[model samples]
Target: MPERVSRQLVYLVYGGKVEYHQEAKYSILSALHHAQGACPRILLYTDEPAQFIGWPVDVITLDDQILRAWTGPATYLHRRKAAAIRDALQYAEQSIFIDTDTFFLASPVKLFERLAKAPWLVDEIEGVWKEYEGDELHTVLAPYLAEQHGIDQRMLLINSGVLGFQGDASQLMDETLNLIDIMHPMVPKIHIIEQFAVSVAARHLGRPAESRGVIKHYFSGKNYWRHMVAAFFLRHGESFSAQAIEAVREVPTDKPRPVWWHRLNFRLRSVFLSSRMRSHAKLAYYATVLCADPYAKACGQGYAQELRRKAIPEGESLSIQPWSRVLTRQQKQRLAKLLGESATGHIP
Candidate 1:
């Protein structure tokens, strides 16, 4: 065994949404399954403690008032992430926070090792500020960040899926919280202000080592992973048991993507479709043909609902021409069934 390193693993889960609770539960299970010899102390800060009743971890329950205060006066919700991690410092000298929508590809001891040396570990380095100068996010905020905060070509934009640091990072957390409060008001609707703030703070603290190889964050393909996780719970049971712990090993860490030829065939079929129509068509294909399990079918239904919202304006009739042009009769029938509509003219 590698030399033992004392650390605390932290998570934040709020809300009663089943999908989110399920994600957190499965994420914890993934961590436990990958922990090789000595395991780090696991701390979960959640509003709904009942959701994790049988899990082997310390639970810090939060009330609405506490949660509201963490978001701060700006009502910038993601600021709560930094605050939650900072609170974990009281429990251990070193702390690592990972998002619920993630799974372990290797033991977290690797991350703890990096954390000991560098004192900063973010999920990934997205890119530098200058690369996205003209995009929607950077076009408006980049100049201000560059001129005011000295954000330049070297300043990175990191994904906050996994964050690791030592308890002495109170100053880092304070500065990150401050940055979040200041930047959020400028782009009130943008979702990534919290992530950028952490990057700046970590850069100030020390060089950041990335955990991409050891941890897999599935935020982009959450729907598929959600289905897979739900399936795991269904096969076993939701309650914690040695059997369930062992069974977690059977769950694949990544979503299985289509082969290249399959992707090419899909692209060729969608060549004549409008971009929006093509996107809807891919959802339909994924639902009906890609996978046969009911979980996959359920995911397909979600995709269908999303397509309906985007393709059909409220109080307007569904448009059949776009789908009709792309889908064959059988595929339309399958998609219609997923949407709970008849195959005649209801497919979106």
Candidate 2:
């Protein structure tokens, strides 16, 4: 086997939110967990460096001016990701920038190995451009893209949740930034334009590889994961230690999947409820029934409350009476029992 090249695991955490910084910390811990004694140089580029005071990583402090400049003329937020990758390249032979929402399932050495062959690592190939031509993302700009950027059926639509490349791929990052600048204003509503740029630019180099097997990006189920991450910090505190690293293994790496009976029960009970209420019902189900584990149940309860808050109209007093009105007497009692309520009236 060829000797491995020096690599750095890079993360970008701005906005100075505690939740987001904590999420990035979990991801970093997961990498360290799977490092198996071969940990890379971990680099964190953030506006708030104080959040990771005790963490074993290089903190590249980013100020507002640099962030604004990286955003460029279009003021596209995601443009910073490309620019961040470009800056991180100077620190190592290969830079693997993983989003804060991701967790490692395998040793990151596998990621570097893939980069050795493919040179680019993206979250996943969602589909070809033609498959989504008529979707909300492309409805406004498909024709223009086809004419201007040669976007077609063969053009890949990639998820940029985990983006990586070697130092030699600086030109690819530059082209990605150029594509972002050119496309952002025209397709501002298309949130993944930066991802599209990465896909297209890397396509020009060669087919970019997917990293799903090595890491899990919970972008689709972000709220659930966020609640779980927050609960983790609340439980163990934010300090990074050997004990904290061991504690990370106790947090569930994936959300619990609802069983067939649980799904059927939720559908039957919530059929009469409005779409908004039914959504909360699923969360309630996860909290009370599916997530018997203490940590996940805590997250599920948080999600249930969050959904319930959103369901209420503005200026109205928050109460469970509205949620209970749609339920039959027997159904209310049943739901109350399932949710561990002492009485049917307590169903909330």
Cα deviation at 334, candidate 1, in Å, is: 2.4
Model 2: per-residue lDDT, tens digit, 1-348?
A: 112337888899999778789889999988888886688888888998888898998888889899999998999988998899888887778888899988898888888888778857788878887787567667866777778777666877788888787438788889889988988887777778888888777766557777978898988877678878887878888999887777878888778656678778778877888887777656555545546665666566555555445554444322354554544555445444443353223433
Runs of candidate 2 with Cα error greater than 4 angstroms are 1-5, 136-140, 257-280, 315-348
TM-score of each candidate structure, all chains considered together: 0.85, 0.84
- The lDDT per prediction is 0.76, 0.76
- List the lowest-lDDT window of 10 residues for candidate 2: 339-348
Each model's Cα RMSD = 4.1, 4.9
